[model samples]
Target: MSRVLLLGGTGDALRIARSLRAEHVYSLAGLGRTPVDLACGVRVGGFGGAQGLVRYLADEAIALLVDATHPYAARISANARAASSDARVPYWALRRPAWEPQADDDWRFVDAWPHVVAALAPFRRPLFTLGREPLAHLDAIPAHQHWTVRCLDAHPGNERARIIDARGPFTLDGERALFDAGGYDVVVSKNSGGAATEAKLQVARERRLPVVMLRRPALPAADREFGDVAGVIDALRAQPFPIVR
Candidate 1:
């Protein structure tokens, strides 16, 4: 049977994997402390790099490559592009639409975490939802202000920053309650987009909170890019069967 390699990270990856008719393998970088519920056979961790990924695709006879990772996961997306070209497999990127600023929103877009830090200097009692990777920058924040950081898990044991161990599809009411109760002065997050984590933005807007939004990294364009799961399904269905050489 032809196998499509579904690069899994985002919720869309799991949805696409579940929708596939052909044999497929769901691949995760294994960044999460616990495994997410996946729809098909799974592979965890990296394929080393582009070269390693190419070898895996060739060796496993991956016919189609679907990248459905977080918008900020640039390295893996680049690797997938290179590996798919080397392996002669069709590649598609499942990118969700980015959030646009509304009339009431106070958004400051920056390129990276350092820029976020520099922009954040004037704000007090800031809340960061940029996930754990960006947590390293927390040490540089002024000691006078107490910061709140939210993550999927509670592993870091960070006493310096107040940690909220929560997962999302968070609601506007929930976000408002959290912010109101925490008495946050400002908000920081990546431009991750999609519905799952967007409530914080809406709440920020309603509360007149200044949002320090990190612009997404420029990812290599795939042979095709899809905005939704149905588009991805159509793309996969259009591909030829996997070949075992």
Candidate 2:
């Protein structure tokens, strides 16, 4: 049987991995502070860039490659595209749709993080839910304005900032409570477009708080693209089991 290499981290990845357990082997970048419960034969960490991934494909005999990483993870997605071409493996992407604002939503779509920082200057208490990696851009927020940075882990390095470490699937009531306690005037978040972290947006709508939403980067053209796991599974199953290589 031909082996499949799955680049997994997002919810879509988990669903596809579970569905195609017999043919797919999952790999995670392991950047998260917490461990994710995935199926057996899962590998963690980088593959040393494109060349490294090429070597792994040949060594493990990966015939089909699935890129199902986070939307903001452009580097790995690019590497997967390059490495698949180099290794002559077929590839596909599981890209979820981004969330659209309702009539009551007060959203500002920004192209980049710097713009998010610039737009935040007017707000005194700005709430950042853009995740830890993107927090590096928080320096652009002027000294006058106070920031409430929320993430999943407490970094010893980030002791000086007002950091709130929490996880979610947050409820609207919970998000409201958080906003109320912080007295936030605005929210800065990536347009990650999923139900998992969308409660913040709902709360922002209710309070009529302005949201600086960072748009997703454009991905490279994939041989096949799917918005859901079922579509990905259907496409994968349609391909021939054996690769010529």
Candidate 3:
């Protein structure tokens, strides 16, 4: 049976990883908690780049490469496609659908950081769900603004900003409490289409707050693309290797 290499970090990726056989490998970028309960082999950290990943695939005899990374992870996805092509392996991607704006949503889409900053100028209290990107701009925060940033890990934030370290699969009540406590006038987010962190959007909608959305990046094409974990699982089952249930 051929071995599979799954590049993953998202919750959706974890679900697919859980279904892989022991011979298959799950790779992470070493950003958050590494799961110890997985049946397949877990490889943490990067593979250098596309060339390095190609070496890894050849060294480990990886026959299938699956890109299950976050939607914002364009570079990694690109590398995965390039590496898979060079290694002569099939490349599959799980492209989760982006969130659609509801009729009540006040979503302002921005392609870059400067635009996000411009969109945020009118709001005094902004809740940033764009991860650690805001942490870098803490010192640049306007005197009138107080930034609240949420990411996977905790960090020491300056007086102008407050960093909250938390993982998602967040509930509506929890999001409501967060919004209430923060008293945020605006929300800064990526169009990461998944249920895990979607409650914030609902909370924003309820409060009638404007969300400064970072536009999704264009990703490389794959031999097969799946919209959800179940689709990927089904595809894997049809592959030559037997999936570990």
Model 3, 158: alpha-carbon shift in Å?
Answer: 1.8
* Model 3 agreement with the true structure over 35-97: per-residue lDDT tens digits: 999999999999999999999999999989999999999999999999999999999999999
* Cα RMSD for candidates in order: 2.9, 3.3, 0.9
Candidate 3 matches the true fold with a TM-score of: 0.98
TM-score winner between 1 and 3, please give it.
3
- For residues 44-101, write the lDDT of model 1, one tens digit per residue: 8889999999999988878788899989899999999999998898898988888999
Question: Sorted by TM-score, highest first, which candidate order results?
Answer: 3, 1, 2
Q: After superposition, how far is residue 63 of candidate 2 from its true place, in Å?
A: 1.1
Residue 241 accuracy (lDDT) in model 2:
75
Off by over 4 Å in 2: 33-37, 137-141, 156-160, 237-245
lDDT tens readout by residue for model 2, 1-245: 57889898776677676656544578888865323454436777999999999999999989889999989989999999999999998889988899899999989988876687678778888888888854674455466777888887775323335887887778888998998898999998988877889999999998999999888997877778898877887877677773111
lDDT for every model? 0.82, 0.80, 0.94
Worst 10 residues of 2 by lDDT: 32-41
